[model samples]
Target: MNKEWFNSRAKINYFDKGYLVICAVLSVIEQQSPLNSTYR
Candidate 1:
């Protein structure tokens, strides 16, 4: 019910989305090139 709580929750959601996006990108890269070391 507080302003600060809402702000932090928004930030956390943004961070989680960013993390998932990165994971998806990595998965695609792995699929394209399974021997690539870029993700490692």
Candidate 2:
């Protein structure tokens, strides 16, 4: 039971890190788009 709990927690942490990375990338794209539009 303890092992199963640890595995689930690790999975959650992995997914959370992935989600954070995706969010960071999306935010960078979003920030760049406005600058691009203004320059054009």
Candidate 3:
């Protein structure tokens, strides 16, 4: 697929990696943080 092609051919961007890491960390916090119930 086109996505696979991009993965093989494109240069990785540090900004893109940082964004994904931030998103993953936020998801873990939302799932397990003590403040989760406070928000809901």
lDDT of candidates 1 onward, in order: 0.86, 0.87, 0.77
Pairs with backbone N, CA or C atoms under 3 Å apart (clashes), candidate 1: none
Q: Candidate 2: lDDT over CA atoms?
A: 0.87
Runs with alpha carbons beyond 4 Å of true place in candidate 1: 34-40
Q: Could you tell me how far off, in angstroms, the CA of residue 26 lies in candidate 1 after the best superposition?
A: 0.4
lDDT of 2 at 33: 88
Clashes of each: 0, 0, 0
Stretches > 4 Å off in candidate 2: 34-40
Q: Mind sharing the TM-score for model 1? A: 0.74
| Candidate 3 per-residue C-alpha lDDT over 1-40 given as tens digits, one digit per residue, 9 for 90 to 100 | 9998787655467667888999997787798868666666
Q: Compared with the true structure, what per-residue lDDT tens digits does model 2 show for residues 1-40?
A: 9999999999999999999999997777678988647655
- Best-to-worst ranking by TM-score: 2, 1, 3
